[model samples]
Target: MLYDLIILGGGAAGIFAAINAKLTHPTANVLLLEKNAVLLTKVRISGGGRCNVTHACFEPKQLIKNYPRGEKELLGPFHVFGPADTIKWFESKGVLFKTEADGRIFPQTDQSETIIQALLQEAHGLAVLIKLTEHIEILENHASYFTLRTKKEIYQTTNLLLATGSSRQGYQWAEQLGHTIQKPVPSLFTFNVPASSLKHLSGVSIHPVRLQILGTKLFQEGPILITHFGFSGPAILKLSAWGSKYLHEQNYQTRLMINWVALSKEETFVKLQEAKTHFPHKTLLQKNLFDLPKNLWKTFLEILGISYKKRLIEISLQQLKNLAQKLTGDRYQVEGKTTHKQEFVTCGGVTLKEVDFKTMQSKICPRLFFAGEILDIDGITGGFNFQNAWTTGYIAGKSSL
Candidate 1:
């Protein structure tokens, strides 16, 4: 039987779109296909399984800032169905959400299953047919309807939605249907500094650190975690995301400048001078000034060639200035990148200009819709990526009907 709507992929956007499409037209025949055995895998593992459903940022203008690629394109969509709408939609389905201090919204139970169950239940209630482990091999548009041929069977639908994240097959199908595919690149990854002196402090986390790509205007400020592999944390992830394309162009070989104290060299110098005067008799190692972790400070001292046994008062003016510069403008060479845990986000997909954000319908092909990371839209860590899924899915589903 020819379906009214067929959503490719059982991810967040595809499943959500299937439910919304059924909700839009109660008797419409909708089918969702997934190559994987389970649906919503990403949702199940998001935010360390708590499932960051959406961010707390409510305003459309402010919410778009989180996305490095779809900032301007998402403005209209977010205004239509933003974080507030996501909260209400899930809450109405019996899932309670709580916003953390970092503005990430998660289920009160802190289990991603809560979210998966809600989406599954809604789809089941709406009679949305779901086929798992089914991969479509060919897609042919017949003007009025689309034909999708799987290895085992063939199906047809009047409207097809491609919510296939960053899959290569998804790009192929989109290209077959006449959409321009942007070259996908890794985003939201950690920098790999194999030769870093701070490698020993694997678990050391510093807050309010400023990270910058040495020769570029790209920079981010937040907490950074020193990993055995390299640097991974909010600031590094943000920087990686914003500079994904550039870093990819550079082959991930670039210089990363960091301000550990998030302060100017001059400010750090003054603070150092104050510490010297206040603790004149104490050894530089004894005071542990500047609020940096004791072990990290010691390592810094070692790297700077300053003796820990040296009294603060005995240090010369040049030595103080050197310490200040090191504290505020440390540089490290980034040799590669590591995926941020299980969350691998990409920086490219279908060109944004080719998709209508209002309806998420493809400008090149009628009745063809796109959503999620499959589009050239990605946001930094938080609920922003999922929010994009929900917003675009809702629009596509509603418009498909």
Candidate 2:
């Protein structure tokens, strides 16, 4: 059957596009194809199953900063359908949302199923046909329509939207359609410090910490979580997104510098010296000047070769300097990386320059569009990526119709 619009991939972007296309033109025929048995798999596992729908960042300019790859290209598209629109769109569908303190927006029910059901219901209500476990084996772009051959059958569509979300098949299809494919690389991952002495301190998190990738200008300041594998948290994930390409080039073997205190070395030293002067009788084990967790502080003292029983007065000037240095610039060798939970993001796909962000349409192929991680657009953790999917999906859907 010839469809007015055929959206490949049943993830957030594809589903959203299908719904929007039908909404824009009620008579238009839309079909969604998913290779997986289930739809919205990523949404089901996002935010530890809560489903981070979008960020509370409403301003397009401010919202663009969260994206490392599509920052510049997404500016115009976000201005059209930004996070505010996403919230309103969901709310219109009776899905209440709550924004967390960190600006991540999730369904008030706190269940990813709520989000999945909302999208599915909207699509069903609009008469959008959804086929599961259907993989398109071949795609041919004719002068007017596109031919897609699946293992089970063949279909044709006038407008095709690819929201495959970093799947290699999507890249191959886009390349086949005369579009340039950027080399895909993993993004939003955690560092794996195999030899880290702080492995026992897993689950310890520090707020307002600074993390810098040594030998590069990549850095991020936020909360850092120490996992048994390595470092996984806002700061590390943000740094990983920004440094995805560089880390991939380095083979995921790089040096990470952590500022536990988020303070300069000299500032940390001064603070330590003040602690010595004011609380000279306080023992190092009992007094943590930086407000770090007790276990983490104890581990730091051990790593610094300083006795926990040592009083502030007993700390020599050199020892104080060393402690300050350690707090401000603790270095770790990242031997590898682990995907940040199940929300695996990629840093590359269809090159941004080759796509028209204004309408999310392919510049090289007429009636062809892209959305979600299938394009070279990935944001750091905290709902920015979803915003991209929604924005691009909305534009693609509306424009295609």
Judged by whole-model lDDT over C-alpha atoms, candidate 2 comes out at: 0.91
lDDT string, candidate 1, 172-288, tens digits: 999999988889999999999999999999999999899999889999999999999889998999999999999999999999999999999999999888989998999878877
- Evaluated with lDDT, which candidate comes out highest? 1
lDDT tens string, model 2, 1-401? 78999999999999998988988999999989999999999999998999999998888889889999889998899889998898888898899999889999999999999999889999998899999999888899999999999889999999999999988999999999998988999999989999998999899889999999998999999999999988998999999999999999999999999999999999999988998899999987777888999999988888889998999999898998998999999999999999855679899999999998888999999999998999999999999888888989898988886
Q: Backbone clash tally for model 1?
A: 0
Off by over 4 Å in 1: none
TM-score of 1: 0.98
TM-score of each: 0.98, 0.98
Displacement of residue 208 (Cα, Å) in model 1 is 0.7
Return model 1's CA RMSD, one decimal: 1.1
**Model 1 Cα shift for residue 309 (angstroms):** 3.0
